[model samples]
Target: MNASYRGGPTVERILPNEEAHELLGLVTEIADGELAPRVADFETRGVFPRDLVRTLGRAGLLGLPYPEEYGGAAQPYEVYLQVLEILASRWLAVAEAVSVHTLSCYPVAAHGGDQVRKLLPDMIGGELLGAYCLSEPQGGSDAAALTTRATRDGEEYVVSGTKAWITHAGVADFYNIFCRTGEPGPRGISCLLADAGTPGIVPQQPERTMGLRSSPIAQIAFDDARVPVDRLVGAEGFGFRIAMSALDSGRLGIAACAVGLAQAALDYAVDYARQREQFGRPVIEFQGIGFLLADLATQVAAARALMLAAARLRDAGRPYSTEAAKAKLFATDTAMRVATEAVQVLGGAGYVADHPVERYFREAKVLQIVEGTNQIQRLVIARSLTR
Candidate 1:
């Protein structure tokens, strides 16, 4: 069974410049040579690829959209998302890790005080892995109803609560902890940057996820963890706005990941179909398999286009939350559909680990659930329309 499937239609992208094109070429080279070879083994063992993430960081892939003064590449959002798409084509877990880490840096980068901005160098450089702690077990979608509390205790804030479904939970060097500081609503929330090694900040065991096993997801319990007042990311009562802003960009990242995953599935299924034979001819020559592959290819292309359009909007510094929602909703749904049909195209072969389609199938399902559920994305878009 070939674990790496690199064959696919060459996408023609209208990049902003030669530098962006070269950057993408570098990413493609790394994806094929590094990520493709190791994904299967890492995923099977359920081991986190911290070293590979470091490698990506060293190569400047981790902070593409951030300012170069903070050790980032200062690439546009459009270019950054393309890098994510390329990475995700080879390995979804790694791409998602990059996305989450980028998101983790948002609160400080966008709204941090002058004191907190000093940490951007390490965080953006990937020397310090970061996690965003927003969704509590009971407040995944209803973020405004969060129960976590942070009280001002002289020079420190005593944080006490559990953050759920946090990627890079135990392994991260720092976390962006969102907790209530005043009244019970979005207005009361505040963001705090806490060291993962802080006493009383305990990480629970990693969840046995259905896919993306190479990435860790767990609950982090803050048992009165004392974060210094200086660690506050933004002004008090501003965490909810910071979180929503970060999520808009995060949704674009997930949408790009979905496009890559779907492309990989379609490519694999097409390759198998071309070689697979029945009735004295290739199976792809038959209308049933041929049409399915055609539709899948078209859908993947459309999803990529939608995702890129949203990224371009962000690049233009326009309001793109609704567009990001639409892209995340469509691209992930397309990935699920494409991966499922890829399995069907391969018949019995896809059901087993002998082919990568099985892994792609499992991986695609989680994209619909993560960042925000497709249903939640619909709600965001619908509200945008009515509002």
Candidate 2:
């Protein structure tokens, strides 16, 4: 089913198509039955759910937006967006982890040589998982300043340095590690695939983040790591551009997830307001409570519109990187705001662990930081305008 906006009727209520309905059902069932039940426990423990990810892979949820030739469901980005939205409504961390996995696989699917292309059937096939590594200790927002080095040695390249804030760092089967192989700065960067368990590629302890605890962000250290020349994602010196391009689309995924999380928060808050009585009546009956609901509804709707607009531009093959940056920046910020406001609406219960809004509040913060920070998004937009 297709929905006009976030506040509008759901796809099931508006225009439920067979494909959308089926995908939604699977995501909702899995999220509700598996993720929803265990998410709090996992989050509190700050543990990664490796088996759950593989289960999604087996269910074909991991490759929903890729091409059928490569064992994907061949769904459009629009449908995939809805699937992500549904998942995020239940658990933002899980949805984002899946999104990161998909994005990590993009370089190979889009730029790999014939031999590499043949691997897509298994990679995008969901049998294998991937991670994208670009951020480093010295370079986070300034990805161009990355110091991770790759020097050619015989048939392979010796890679060294570290990549920080890598999602799924330890559990991923492979990584699209961006390294400097030529001149300094962005032009020198090149993307290479390194197996997680390979020598010299060490995933250190997972970062104890403020939120998204289960996704497992970490620093990957590479000391004299050797990468096969054939593992290059694209031609030498194209890593930065390749990484940036993947992030363009990847940001949209974050936007969609943020919108989903915000939407869920709004939905829950509104329901809670209706049920929670105030001095004389239901809190939702009062103007103050109604105003809060109105504001949250507007924010969620606006964020969804922005996300879909960016997605449509991508689908049309337009230059959508700037638009994507805007979506990610604005939508994630809105999510954080909306989630916090939702807690306010919940009053004392909001402060307690009785509701998921507390979790939503925590999850929203990471969206602003990943795929590029909000500050970097502004730079991309500004550069696009001036260029």
TM-scores, each model vs. reference? 0.99, 0.94
**Model-by-model lDDT, in order?**
0.92, 0.83
Name the candidate that leads on lDDT. 1
Q: For model 1, how does the per-residue alpha-carbon lDDT over 290-318 read when each residue is reduced to its tens digit?
A: 99899988999899899989988998989
- Relative to the unseen true structure, what is the Cα RMSD of model 1? 0.9
TM-score of 1: 0.99
Task: Using TM-score, give the best candidate's number.
Answer: 1
Point out the worst 10-residue segment of candidate 2 by lDDT: 1-10
Residue-wise lDDT of candidate 2 within 78-157, one digit each (tens)?
67777788778777778887899889888987888876777787777566778889999988888899999999999999
Overlapping backbone residue pairs in candidate 1 total: 0
